[model samples]
Target: MDKEDLKKLVQKIISNHQIGVLSSVENSKPHVRYMTFFMKDFILYTPTKKNTEKIEEIKNNPHVAALLGYVEKGSNDEYVEVTGICSISEDKDLKEEFWNDSFHNWFNGADDPNYVLMEIKPEAARILNSEHMKTMEITL
Candidate 1:
């Protein structure tokens, strides 16, 4: 798909689902954590505490998976699964742009020492709608 298609699909999926289940590896075991994420500049951002297990797991294994979609009891809806490599970024501008009140609860205020941002640069994303699926391959 072209960049516009991908961008539109991303916005659609993100808008439909505000919660994401982020999977990471820790102690050679897989761990999944549900988090509220906001995106900026096409980069997925998740604010976490400096000492959280998720942060350490990402440190040990950068590969991660994010599931962003939901289904009601009887409704059929497609979901996006994005698997990518993640990095802890300290970009001042990005931190400011994605900042919000929820973060304040975790950070105890802006610029809290425990605040850390995880940047997921997707390597490959597959949109699954039952038997129909499309994959968007990425570079870097």
Candidate 2:
């Protein structure tokens, strides 16, 4: 696939998916966990608590990776893998923007001081399918 097709593929997967695996370097090893994400203009955001271990790991190392677009039982094997540079953000407007009713389970509110967003700017991305022969990548 060409760059434009790859971009469209990325948009289709990420825009349709919300849950993904986010990884950060911890003690020279990869530390990964499930996170709810938001995408806009190809940028990724994952809301998290400021004091979480992932925050410290990201602070010590800004590079991260994420996997999105997979579902149970491998029914939908197609997915997007992203390697990106991550930074922490506490912008109130963003907090408000990313907030949703479901977040109430983990946060007191969007204004909660512990709440923060991890902004990930993709350096590289690829779409893969375990059940298909299709795969493509692009650098940004």
Candidate 3:
């Protein structure tokens, strides 16, 4: 597919999926966990507590990877693998913008000092659709 087509497909995949596996490196090994993600265009954001191990991992190594878009157990499943740089943001406006009631379980509220946002700026991506049987690469 063309670049525009590929971008549309990637956007669709991201829009349809809410949770993804975010992988970060720690002590030269890979550590991954499922995180609830929010997207604005191509950039993705995931909220987490300040004391989490992933926070430290990102601090030590900003390079990260993520996987999104898994629909079901079938041959037609499509997913996107994203490689990017991650950074922590504590901006109150940003926190309020992405805040949801669900986050209260882990955070006291949007103003909670422990609450922070992990921002992933996509550097490259690979989209795999079982039906297509080919991987499409995207650079951002």
Which candidate has the highest lDDT of all? 3
Q: Write the per-residue lDDT of candidate 2 for residues 3-107, one digit (tens) a residue.
A: 877877787888788899998999999998999988877889999988989999988999999999978666657899999999999989988999998998889
Model 1 scores a TM of 0.83
Clashes of each: 0, 0, 0
User: For model 3, how does the per-residue alpha-carbon lDDT over 1-140 read when each residue is reduced to its tens digit?
Assistant: 88888878887888799799999999999998999887777788999999999999998999999999987984778998889999998989889989999998999999999999999999988999746899899898
- Candidate 1, residues 1-140, lDDT tens digits: the string is 77667666775786678688999998888799898776665667787887888877888899998888766641456677778888887777777777788776668755666777888887766666632354454343
TM-scores of the candidates in the order shown = 0.83, 0.91, 0.93
Q: Is candidate 1 or candidate 2 better by lDDT?
A: 2
Which one is best on TM-score? 3
Full-model lDDT, candidate 3: 0.90
- Model 3 alpha-carbon drift over 4 Å, by segment: none
Error of 3 at 59 (Å): 1.0
Query: Order of candidates by lDDT, top first?
Result: 3, 2, 1
